[model samples]
Target: MSQRPRLHAPTKRLDIQGLRAVAVVLVVAEHVFAQPIGGFVGVDVFFVISGFLITSLLLAEHSRTGRISLTAFYWRRVRRLMPAAVVVIAATLAAVLLLVPQRAPQSLADAGWSLVFLANWRFADQQTDYFAADGPVSPFQHFWSLSVEEQFYLVVPVLLVTTLAIGRRSSPRVVALSTLSVGVVASAVLAPIQSTADPETAYFSTPVRAWELGVGSLLAFGTAIWGRLPAWFGTSLSWTGLVGILVSAVCITGQGAFPFPAAAAPVISAAMVLVGGVRGPTSGAAVLRAGPLVSIGNVSYSLYLWHFPLFIVIGAVDPSAVWWTVPLSIALAYVSYHLIERPCSVAPLAMWHRRERARFREALRPQRRSVQVSAIGLAAVTAVVLSLVATDRVRPIDIPTVPLAADATAAPTVGGEDRPALAALGKGIVDALSATSWPELDDGPGANLVGTQHPECGRLSPAPSAETCTFGSPTAERSLMLVGDSTAVHWIDAYLRLQDDGLLAGWRIVTRTAFGCPFIDASLGGQDATECASFRADTLDRITEVEPDVLVITNTFADTGVDGDGTAPGAAEWAAATQRYVVDVRESVGKVVLVSPPPAGQSVQNCYSVGGSPSACITETSSAWRSRLAALNAVAGDDATVVDSRPLFCTADTCPAFVERTIVKKDFVHLTSAYARKSAPALGELLRSRSVFEDTLVGH
Candidate 1:
């Protein structure tokens, strides 16, 4: 619609503009629509383009003047980037304050960090939690890429200057390429390892991503050396490059290792497109220089800036209206380019050395000073708003004590109103923070509950055979084995304390837990499915070898391949798996206890940190768990003793997250150590009733 930006002179390399359009579109599509395309690689494409264009400009400047002007370069970067960034960030913070007060504190902090270009480090330190997916997307989260590029812009100039200064005998290109090559190789080497060890940290860290930008800088050297190539070669290279990029988008998903070899496809392919742009006016060049693509490319920067916040805001208002995100983003990008970007970036150049008289003499003069005052006012208002949000606090709900029933192991009744006492406790916690509470939670949603105290032993996925942790006496007359995943870890401390106190004098306990790997006969869904099957087999063998008098089976509903509904297609298969495990275990162990998992609640830790009352995170029932338990019952038959955990964790209609002033679950589903210890009496009593520990004398 609007004319292509004249500042960069489009005809010089119109294809780069087309690439920009493609990159921004990919990013927007992925974020807004959750497309299967690995559109995240779009940022890597931007990194390469930035490396090439900026290096090309710096080299050109050095060739002309024999040195780079650091002041001019930085000023231009700030001039081009900062104005629009400030506007978008301020607006995003303001929107958060108005719409999602619960996220206000976090959004304010993110904005503050983003302003200084430290968002990537901040997110890395936070570990960028996956559980927070249920919450509103942070509007400023996309600034991590901007922070990376800004960091690159800061370091590269100094690196080139130092390298050239030290290697006076060598050509500038040689020194530049050598410096960039070293960074590329070192970072490339580290990406895969770091990605495997800590993917969240690896994804956000500067060093891991530096190689991507370095690869682009190296491409500049190649371009300089080769100059223009044949037209036919350029066309073929462009087509192949496009195909490679498309393949990467189609093939790559966000599971497993990323940003190392997987990212190489898009990055190298983008490089190909850049290289092919050398000899212009070919068929491929014609496609890139087309009017529509050129227009989008011209405003690609604004598109990138506006899209994320717009998508977040749309979701905040009405999650179902995701369709509005793309069209509105394009419209806003166009408006932002014309109204803010063009005037701020270009007018300063026009007015750089003008006399005050010239402006006074003009008939239709630009109100540059008014615009400055308005911008400053907006910034000041944003600061004040964020300050209020950051400092806001809500009073925590007063806890009401309820005595733990000595017979808490009583069987829960089916489909009835919550017993009065449990209902009261749930109401108190839910009312802790009012619906209109300020500044949200400090910690984050339910991360604590997902973690275990003995993380070293219990948190492994497909844990090694030697990963077992033993409690109680090795020479005890009776043995008990607790096996499954993290869900079983919650009950461990309780059992260990019982053994420590000598309640069961002749009993030994062994626990084998692998997070996400319930001892099922069936394979799991993700990349580690086969490995989990192997773990299930290994754990079964361990159970048989120990030949424990009693075996406890516990796992979350997620193990059944049913996320919400228990009656999903895979329920029968899960039941069969449970039955298979049960049949195998019955042969070795005298008794088996199939522990029904606790009801899944909202992140209580997150709720507490967010100033939520107990009720906010507390729920009445874990329907999903109920469905899974039913599935387990259908196939488990009479071989195993079903230890229904409802009475221990819930009170008929309501499941309370807190009991006797202690937080029951650290996160959504895992029990805290203190809560586990408190539950030992009930669990110990239940086991005795089932004859699991009837032979042993129980004394304090």
Candidate 2:
């Protein structure tokens, strides 16, 4: 049998400090600029470096002592990682309490999960409908990465120790390397597939992250392989790898188009740099060894810990001051490193090293004690988190649930299938446009948009195209035409209530799904996009053909411009375009009623996913939304009667999803049919106050 070569400890530390600097910078850039498709690959780089360094130390200990002490390993990890983590978590909790009022319950629940390192599952469950325009932001969003690393730490040691138990006779290096290889192959193959299947969940899940760590482990075990590479080859690989890292950071944008196949570029590139640049006195290695870079690398952990909270706090306090806030955040991060982080890290390491020189075994026992204490501290944290969660569940927000009306409009009977009554009214409008048939509309359930389709005229044949899908109603004597985007369709339920009550005596409802078009002379993709052109032409034709009394137009006035909060579009451009749309609509129709949208709310699905209950998702009143609505209302003024529903939907303390047993909205903003009916009284009062009903009744 061949004898195993004695394990050789690395005389030089891999540029871990340099690697950390790269990781921290990439993460900071991702949050601040949100560019570079591979910006997220920085986490993968961290994972690989962690696995490599940790494995090397563990293997070295096992080789020297013939056994590994799980307690000592965990103690060192806890001392190195937990103190900063605990401080950050505690500080964040305090900030949330003081700075964030009317917090989303779902966010609170996510924070609870994060405290316990279960953020991966919490985020996974909530990411199902990840494409929803409105979703609550978890305050502890960064903790998911920590959870992945912690989970790896917990599992990898067990696997390593088990392998040792089975192979005291075989080479521990071979066994460790073999296991790492298997993990790397499995993770790389599974990660890409998962990214395609469910990108949001895959992004946060730990299993998918294992491959990054496995890559580092493999490198650590194959140090001899790297050592044997030619100097020229290593230098070329190192420079190329650094270039790839920079390219990934500069090119990748965080708008759901990243952290997938594109992420492979940065992950592979970072690995190559780590492997190739860790040897010799090459230029790449020399750069990493620079004084400033090495110092930043040493304090990288502190910088990472402080930067996020500083940004979040600054943004919360002065959202419009991004220019100053960005620089201020960096300043605060540097101060935190110098004041808190450097002192703490140096003190602990000094104490640990001093004790290691004398009474080594006795000193190691204290390390085990520290590990036990950390374990107890973790348990206490878990209990506190569970208690908060329990308390939250037991004493949820006191949202009043209103009962549904006994005389609520009945569902429409369609081919023996019961459908929302409002759907029938919309069908009537479609039928009238198709056949050009007029029928007497009664003030019955079918007259309501919720009840039946085209009560005046029987069912018409289906139209072949968008141009042909039209309907006319005898009640449409004044020719009221509804037009715009999906927001227009949302208002149909409310319009049906007016129609059922004999308010829209002469009107025709028309709709087109123009994905993101405002009803004006707008260009999309550097040209007059189909939706914009169609909207302008169609409105002109409809006005000429129908000669409408009142034109009701509504579109989400927030999505037609640049985004401010890194999630949704800003309101400045949207407000301007909406004002223009109102002007054009007013010119075509004698009267126009511009409805300001409801208070922006959290996604119902996201809340349920995270909090496990509908009541747990509360709508947030965004200042941006309020500002845009105000701007729109200011522009419309009396020329367009602005119908604001803020009072009807929200109270001073809370916004109840269901008002009087009727679901006010289907998602974040659109009203449900039952809820729309409830709005009839308030809407009628608004119309009367604005002389809208008077104009219709007097026929002037």
lDDT by residue (tens digit), candidate 1, 1-700 = 2222243333578888888888888888888777735887788889888988988888778778888888989887887888888999988887766655666788899999899889989888988842134233468888898899889889998888787777767676677778778888999999998876777888887889888888778877676444467777877887788777777777776554667767889999988888888665443546777789888998899889988987776454433344666766676676667567765564344353445324422412344544455455545644653353334322233332342344333335322142443344344333432333433332233333334556655755536444347766677767778888778877788778778664555578888877767776665654346667677777888887888877888877653432222122355666677778888767787678788777776545333333323344445564456666777777666787777776566654356556655566766677777767766656666565556655322221
Give the per-residue lDDT of model 2 (tens digit) for 618-643: 45456666676666666776667766
- Candidate topping TM-score: 1
TM values, all candidates: 0.67, 0.57
- For model 1, the stretches where C-alpha displacement exceeds 4 angstroms are 1-11, 129-138, 163-170, 224-227, 281-292, 310-328, 347-413, 416-482, 488-517, 520-552, 556-583, 590-700
Give the count of colliding residue pairs in each prediction. 12, 31
lDDT of each: 0.68, 0.56
Q: Which candidate has the highest lDDT of all?
A: 1
Model 2 residue 7 lDDT score = 20
